[model samples]
Target: MAVKLRPAGILLAAAGALAIAMPVLLLLPGGGGAVPRAAPVPAPIGAGTMPVLARVYERPLFGASEPVEAPADAPRLVGIVGRLNIDAVALVKASDGTTRTLAIGESVDGWSLASLAIDAAFFTRGAERVRVPLPIEPGGSEAGTEETGR
Candidate 1:
């Protein structure tokens, strides 16, 4: 039976031969002498000492920091749909007189809708938060609610 050498086998055999021959060739005279190592660097006199750094206080990027009521020009919450917080969306009337439907994490007029409830939408900008509740109609019901006469 004859054994045939495949292309992969031939390449692997060549690699093995090169690996075996490399060390022998390097050991031969003037065949790239042993590589010289770098000298150790000495530490400076005060290298072990750490300098005293001033304490830095960073302001919080989120959460209410004495949040005031929404400004008169701020967007108004017109209505809210969906009961679950995750799926709820708020309809807002922006200062530009355009009505926008916003979901949690959605932004309108630079304020992001951080969360939503059945009757209100909470928006945040930087550390300031504003809660906009659905306006109540003259019938004493929320704007989006129907009067059942009960």
Candidate 2:
């Protein structure tokens, strides 16, 4: 019996041989150094700080709206009357000088209290969520003395 190779078989055999030789070729001397590693790890833009993403996700089905920017006359968060709970209320003084205590999910005027933290309260109007920080008292403390969650 005589051995015979078809075009497809020969091409396949050549491909297999090359595939097997690749690792060996890479291991051989004079191969390029370290295969040039995928474009160095990418250095952070600022002092080891990764860029924060500011994009807001909107869920149309859930009636979720995009975060809205607080207007210039937005009410100022004066203080947190309670801890983070159902009973926790945010003391907000509006532009008209009327102060109100608002619990979570409560709305005053057109602003709805969305969340409350230790030093700040978030209000939502339409698709916008605005964060109001507690104002510093004149005798309270220096501005830069405390960390503001930068």
Candidate topping TM-score: 1
Clash pairs for candidate 2: 67-128, 68-128, 68-129
> Can you list the residue pairs that collide in candidate 1?
none
Candidates in order have lDDT scores of 0.80, 0.77
The window of 10 residues in a row where model 2 has the poorest summed lDDT is 55-64
Once superposed on the true structure, which residue ranges of model 1 sit more than 4 Å away at CA? 1-68, 143-150
- Per-residue lDDT tens digits for candidate 2, residues 1-150, read 998889999999999999999888888886645665577776657846643444333234453266444578677887887557756888888778898888887887788998898878888899987777777768788565866775
Predict model 2's lDDT versus the native: 0.77
Window of ten residues with lowest summed lDDT in model 1: 50-59
- Residue 33, candidate 2: how far off, in angstroms? 28
TM-score of each: 0.48, 0.46
Clashes of 2: 3
What TM-score would candidate 2 get against the native? Answer: 0.46
Model 1, range 1-150, lDDT digits (tens) per residue? Answer: 999889999999999999999999998987968789899988888867745444223434575566457777567998887776557788899889999998888888888988887667888888987788777778786544775675
Candidate with best lDDT: 1
